[model samples]
Target: MFWFFCAALVIIVGLAILTPVWRTRGDNGAETAAGFDLQVYRDQLREVERDLTRGVISAEEAERLRREIGRKVLEADRRAGEESPAARRNSAGWIGAVLALALLLGGAVWLYEREGVPGMPDLPLAERIAAAEAAYDSRPSQTEAEAAAPVPDRGEIDADYAALIEELRAAVAKTPDDPQGLALLSMHETRLGNLEAAITAQRHLIEVKGPDATAYDHLMLVSQLIEAAGGLITPEAEDELARALQLEPQSAQGRYMLGLLQAQNGRPDRAFPIWRDLLEEGPADAPWIAPIRAAIPDLAWLAGQPDYTPPKTAMPALPGPDADAVAAAEGMSEEEREQMISGMVQQLESRLATEGGSPEEWARLISALVVQGRADHAGEIWGEAQTRFAAQPEALEVVRKAATEAGLAE
Candidate 1:
């Protein structure tokens, strides 16, 4: 039906263009203004001759009129001779009409062929939603996805490190319920590209934590599951994501994984808003921010907003000691390095206290305090961060991770 309408429109336009050329074809040899003027002048000269014969006008008058008429005739004849022949004019007109029509039709066809899906039928909103649902229901399982995924290359490890990993694995296998051992195993396995093993260890960690497992714990399991399946958010990962969000409704990573699951299951309409909100509520260096920024434009298009422009948000400057300070300290004597680091940490602490800072800065401050053997001060800062970022769950999560590392949180 669409093709029929296009063809009809082309025919109508073509006819409008060619009609004028065809109608004017018959008029090509018709008498022109110059020819008509020449004929009238000759008639007037004949009348003058009649007047002279009848003695109504003298020979002088008659000859004067003849001379004037003859001059006018010469000018009219010159103009007529300069005009193009009717056949040549008609041929050129036909050629121009043909070219115009060809360009119009051919250009339309070429553009459509280049940018359009030629034989695809129009998919209504309802049908499209149904198709998406079908795809979501039929997506691959976790085991199937992992089986199909290519093995990742983890370059050669040091012999001592490999031996340490074997010992860790044996320790975890011997005491399967040990959470710390499982966490260590998971981390090292992931580093060595043993994703399945990493996932298994993480799952065991979560089981050991049981009711004590926080949203972050489930999110860890989700991450391992996703990585093991080569980035596919399989059913197992989705369930874990839902459980994480259920445990902590404000979990940033859980929300990110939910959006990812929606996107993978062909529901960009659902995914786009989640990601857009995450992007807007950002610290710029949040782990999910980069991926959200990269994916949202296409997600917006998929959600029927082709003209949507993402907000331009600049990344905030790092609030702690800069890289140059660290490099300078690297070449100093141990005591000098310690003094330099202490100075830098004091500077960071002053700036953060005076102007406030991003969650990342707070996290860095907490870690630095722990490293300086000021666990009491670090605990005080962590307590303050909880109050400061109480309303911002994602930011609080960032600070909480550092607190956990410093033995300040579970």
Candidate 2:
């Protein structure tokens, strides 16, 4: 069908060009300017003779007119007898028209051959979506993916480290229900490139945690599962992600993993918006932010938004004492300065508790408490921030940093 339309267009253009050439050629034999001039001169000669017969002019005057008209008539006759330039131009036109048509058709064919798919069928939206679904359904299982994945090469370990790992494995085996041992075993196994072993240990850790398992615990299991499958979000990993979200409905990590699953399963239409929202609700330093920014432009193109541009992101300003407050503190005595600083901290905490605040404010408050030798209170504030920013991974990360600095988290 495409070829047919191309051929029809070529023919239409050829006709428009060739029709003028053919018409000009056919009119080449018709009366030309020289012929018409000769006829006018002959008519003028006849008029002069009639004027002589009617005595409108003297004989000498009439004779002069006859000679002038006769000379013009002879010149016109000579010119009319010669071949016209139109004949030569008509002949050249035919050659030019043929050459132009040939060039047009040849260029069209060459361009299409270079740039177009000759036999591919049209892919409309519905067909494309169906194809994506087919690919999603036919994806390999976790075991198959792991089997096909390339093995990582960890250079030989030191003898002491290798012996320690073996001893840890034996210890974990003896204490199968020990969450701490399982967690340590998982971490060490992951470090040693034993992804399968890491996944097994993490799974056992979650099982031992049981009803006490947090969303973070399940997410850790999911992370190991995905790594074991060589970054493919397998069915087992997806199940763990669902469980994590069930435990904490506002889990940012779980939502990010969910978006990743959708992306891997040929559903960028679903993934793009999830990642876009995460990008917009950001503190700019979340672990997921980098990957989302890297992948979103392509996802948006796939989602039929070829013009989408990611929003700019920057670190939020943390709330704290201003320059004026620092300057005023320089003149006060130590005791008085302490009182003023304590009052400011208390005021910030009160406003945050009463009206809520940004993750930066929460983090600032946590840091302030820690500076005042209030580690226990910092831990409590960190817990509250985790719950408050649970749905926003970027925001949660900001507070998590302060909590980690206060020695409240690893």
Candidate 3:
């Protein structure tokens, strides 16, 4: 019985092996090699194209079918190609693609490096312009009277202006041909109340700098100062202003200052026409417009009147600092500087303890503080003066004005 069972198992195993060969032969019997039906597919595609050309299918319909068939064929081709050794053979083609990508990246980087295209936004142009304009427009923000005055420095010292003057002087010493520097120096000297020095600097500036706008401004300002001091305008000053007028034909400040000279020289008629022309051409919001208009009515009233006589009050000479304090401030160490400043404050306090500082002394102290760049100390001193000298309005007012001009006001 065991031998019969073994014989049946061998027969079943033999049939299992032979069955696969038979089925494989049968499945491939009607096809050619490589398991592909190439002729059948070719015939099917040709029949679809013929139908489209014969108008049996619409163009869009033919296109859609063509796309579908193309997608299927391409997918099949890829699958077959992947299964074969073709994918491995195409390594050079992949390298070519990599090289193409590298070339594209290199070109992009080169363009970016060469061009100045900003990578990010800065402050907007309009906002920057508005901020700049706001910085210059002191009229609406400050009181009308305050706006009329020059901006003061830290301790009523006009330190920045003085520094600018010193720098200009140094620059002129180094390079005498620097006209812009000379003109700037002239402006600074004028503000420092050194009219003769200012006029000399401006004369040099006009000769060297030639047609500068600021030089022109300095020339006008210097001319006005000369006329105010009851001095005749020098030939050099006259020539400088004439050149400036040529440079800026519509220079309102120049015209006004020239008119001031004319008025002072007892030629009201000459001054009147020049002023009238400026008033006609100037913007209503111009800084000098209101003053010019005010002067016009006064000029009309004084048409036939003699030129206004100069005031006889002899202007006091500018006071220099106390020698000891000047030397100490100049020579002191950082700690010693503070001590010197404190001592000055104490001296002022002690002075006020008795009869209080004179207005001139207050002005001098404010000037000293400004020269030393001690604005806070100056301010504290001013506050103390205000408290102690409240009964002396003249002194308080003078100190307060000095403080405001020095930019020490709270």
Candidate 4:
């Protein structure tokens, strides 16, 4: 019985010892599997490196292959470490496996929470579109009713127009002498189909500001409005334009007005010359060139007539010292020179009003008028000089050049 007991104890001890060796053998098998996988990965890495060195594969491709192989090797190593036979043989190993599984599950959940699981990010877009469609569908009956309703009548429309007119009228009344207000009034009247009122307002503004580009712009608007109303320039309109020309002779506005005035006054002869001169002087892309060209077909036959000489208008002379003044007044003081200029301006204004003066006196007077804050007056004289000296274009050109050099135009 003692021998039997001893034999049983020895058997149990032997089995216990062998169990750990078996577990070690299983662990070795797992380790060998992992090592084999590692070797395979190392082989792939070496192949990629060789390909890169030989220029068979690009650096980027080799790097990607190496990274993939490394990831696979690392996963195999981790699996082998987690599931070794030695770990399974020991009670602690089983406990470790449970803990590892728990850790893996928790890590997976954490990763999913942090980096997101694949294919679940489109929820917001779908929800927003659904909400929009629902909102749109909810109001369909109201939308249909609104679409079927009749538009408001003209009385309602005129209420807004009347309000606008009152606002503009009040603005004009508040700033009675304001040229900008008057111009706005003119434009408003024009849009409202009141061309005559537009013209009158513009004319009043011109008289207030004297001859200027702003006045010319207003006049051009008036001219277009009037032509739209009907043809023929009225006598009062002509007189007002003549005053404008007197203020700025070389002004395109002045010349354009003069052409209209002459055409309406039964003198196409005069009008044709002015229009031709403007056409020659204007830029190729000038806004008025189109209208002037359209009028040209009507005047092409005039070119063949005996009285037609393609009347040349001179450019307005700029303000400056005349040759005689430069020569005779070299020894004068600044004050004395100013006094002389003042006297010359008076004489020129007087002669221009009367239409009786030599070109030399006219030149001096124009120069002096420019010096006396009458640049618009000088511009008108220059325009007139161009028309009057149509037969002497070169001489008038020389006179204009000299006036410009003497600061007459600026």
Best TM-score among the predictions, by candidate number: 1
Cα lDDT tens digits, model 4, 121-213, are 444545755654465344323224324434311111235655786798798888866889887786555545444566667666766676454
TM-scores across all candidates?
0.67, 0.57, 0.33, 0.33
Better of 1 and 3 by lDDT: 1
Worst 10 residues of 4 by lDDT: 149-158
Off by over 4 Å in 3: 1-168, 211-221, 224-236, 302-410
Per-model RMSD to reference: 10.0, 10.8, 30.3, 30.0
Global lDDT of each model?
Answer: 0.80, 0.78, 0.56, 0.58
| Model 2 accuracy (lDDT, Cα) | 0.78
lDDT of 2 by residue, 9-47 (tens): 988999998998888787775346777798898899889
**lDDT tens readout by residue for model 1, 13-50:** 99999988877875664346667888899899889989
Q: Number of the top candidate by lDDT?
A: 1
Tell me the lDDT of candidate 1. 0.80
| Overall local distance difference test of candidate 3 | 0.56
What's the number of clashes in each of the models?
A: 0, 0, 1, 14
Q: List model 3 lDDT by residue over 101-168, tens digit each.
A: 56755675577568845354355656655654454342221123223434333234445645765777
When sorted by TM-score, best at the front, the candidate numbers are 1, 2, 3, 4
Ranking by lDDT: 1, 2, 4, 3
Global CA lDDT computed for model 4: 0.58
TM-score (C-alpha, index-matched) for candidate 1: 0.67
